[model samples]
Target: MQEVPVQRQHVGGSVCLLRLLGGDGHRTVRGFLGGSLLMNCKYWHGDEMKPTFWCKLGTDSDCAADIVITSKNQSMVWRERFSIRDNHAGKLFMVTTEGLAEGDMGTYLCKVQRSTTQREESYGVKVMVSTNTSAAMR
Candidate 1:
């Protein structure tokens, strides 16, 4: 969850919604996302951990989503194991099984909804399970 500079609006109407509030859009993934281009929406159950995203919020399938993976590496903690709540299978948002180890890196969040009162986009990720440990942590 990085590359945030949004200013949403959807209030004062019968449940209009879109928000990200302040700058909670975290970031800590691999790095170099300066141009924005990462999205999978779904299809990584080979173990679970091909997490990559920068933006892919308009393919039209109704596009409803919810995903969260977190970590800031504070001695390691198992936060946000998995997510997929209001997903209409917009391709895929997240999955779990055994990918993204290293105590599961940190800093990740994806939230998009067409309901839930109002929210259209959200992302802030930072998971690095690649130290060349033979490779395989998504």
Candidate 2:
């Protein structure tokens, strides 16, 4: 059975409060080892442009340590396996990974960096990778 996406918000104990918005904010996304995974995140903060980052959930709660790819305007990380696209009119960002592998299996967070604030407002997505997709279907 397919998993259902959830929506929720999280507040840090400290001054910074991060809210998860859009997509499967509470469900884990499943994919085959060799397949690709796609994620979409949205944020709106006036006309000023902000940078969007995708990171893996590491041993520590710090998201910065697991940095993967970042996108801003028409520029972003230039990597063969990673790509990002933006829906300019809708303020939606799409992150796609090619040749998914065991190492890629993990929880990921997407956030837009607002220059006005020091804290990062993000959306969390869990990813589960399987080596045998055919067997799992049975």
Candidate 3:
């Protein structure tokens, strides 16, 4: 992975926008069946007070159907097998998915909702789950 500098700009009074200069906002992750996967998403400093969302990619590639969403004032949110924790000081959030299965293999989106004036920033993640048949056979 290449290292990119974090750019911060004031969109308006008290609102900041963070952008990564030379990187595509997509990632591919592999996990074993019945295990867990963790994804880290970074955002702007001012976005700490904003809401964060984690959702399976909808048919139209939108986050219309969210699996879990964090409150603006809360640091953590959980729903069923999905959980999201926001680290304000670090300007990043972590999403954990438990009980991985074949059905969990798909694209997920992590989004940080900005002020109404600015569009939300989203990161696309592709999850691939596989089973270790050899280990199961043994």
Candidate 4:
């Protein structure tokens, strides 16, 4: 019998090959004023349930600021404009934004806590918001 090796890439001192598993990588998502957008993150097939958090990347720090939501203890709080939803059967989380505004334009991250001290994160999702109507463009 022959053995096949799985390919891997090191990302922030962690191995992340989820991009090859039908998951999104670093990319930009565009939305228009008064529109909506969805960002997605997937879990490995057998990953133990852990806290999932969505946050906006900070301008001046390695840490993420503007935490959008989290799935710790199966509890969550959402602002009127942002929310996070978990799909257990699909092993993923969807971060949604409604009534988009210019302030919503930025980078976001989806992270999963593997353990008390370990976490895995998806590539950044940059959000771009534009005026949806010609009158608004002026």
Candidate 5:
């Protein structure tokens, strides 16, 4: 089986959706990531290890963040939590290329965990954050 290939990555702030192509039975994923914090990928139940996705505070503040991710549906799973240390100054998601506006401000988390298998992986919902700018209020 050679239809699918291994995903190669080592760059920071890189986003990818890794998929296993040629393998039988249960599979797992392993790798090291460091920049501001430790990030791990999680999936849904019945599914096994695959790939972990991480989002960090980029191009702003101290290059650090208090970013956290978790599943939106898993009310019982707590191991799917993620964190980004050394959070920078200023408003959150302010310096990021993909960020919020004056009326866009709130909380965001990515919930992911695998079922049956040990590895956790899957996509999550990013909470939309908006702001409000007014002259009289200022």
Candidate 6:
């Protein structure tokens, strides 16, 4: 995979803007085991009408196994332990994963599906699950 430049701007709390030049970039996120994690991914303004998806990166480097998919008509979509919300006005999307486990430590993808002729725009995210010793004690 080719490396792309990334610009991060804090957007309050756990939210941030991940700006990528060619609409693709890599980022790292951490979450406590048995807790949750939130990831925000930015996209071009005009692309907001398109569908957005979140999934663990598969061997083919595509969203072959989608965790959650948000429709243009619906601002949010939830499935099992995963939820995705699209903020069309903000030109960004937020994905939340709850009840994290050790197996969740891997690469994920934030993708936008475009016209059939166009390739999907995506942002790569690496998730790391850390154990909370204090919580484990209790």
Model 5: CA > 4 A from native: 1-3, 13-17, 21-23, 33-138
State each model's CA lDDT, in order. Answer: 0.31, 0.58, 0.69, 0.57, 0.26, 0.72
Kindly give the number of clashing pairs for every candidate. Answer: 16, 0, 0, 0, 25, 0
| lDDT tens per residue, model 1, 19-133 | 2222454543331111111222322223122232222123453212323432222211132434232222333343231233454454444543334564545454444455442
Model 4 TM-score, 2 decimals: 0.67
TM-score of each: 0.25, 0.69, 0.77, 0.67, 0.20, 0.77
Q: Give lDDT tens digits, candidate 3, residues 76-99.
A: 988888899988887878788877
Winner by lDDT between candidate 2 and candidate 1: 2
lDDT head-to-head 5 vs 6, winner: 6
**Residue 55, model 5: Cα distance from true site in angstroms:** 20
Comparing 1 and 3 on lDDT, the stronger one: 3
The global Cα lDDT (0 to 1) of model 2 is: 0.58
The residue pairs found clashing in candidate 4 are none
RMSD per candidate (Å) reads: 17.2, 10.4, 11.1, 11.1, 17.0, 5.8
lDDT digits (tens) for residues 1-138 of candidate 6: 343434332223222223332334567666556766777777777898999988888778766698898886887998988899998988878888878889988898888889999978888888777685333222
Off by over 4 Å in 2: 1-20, 23-25, 45-48, 64-77, 116-118, 134-138
Better of 4 and 5 by TM-score: 4
Residue-level error in angstroms, candidate 5, position 112? 13
Best-to-worst ranking by lDDT: 6, 3, 2, 4, 1, 5
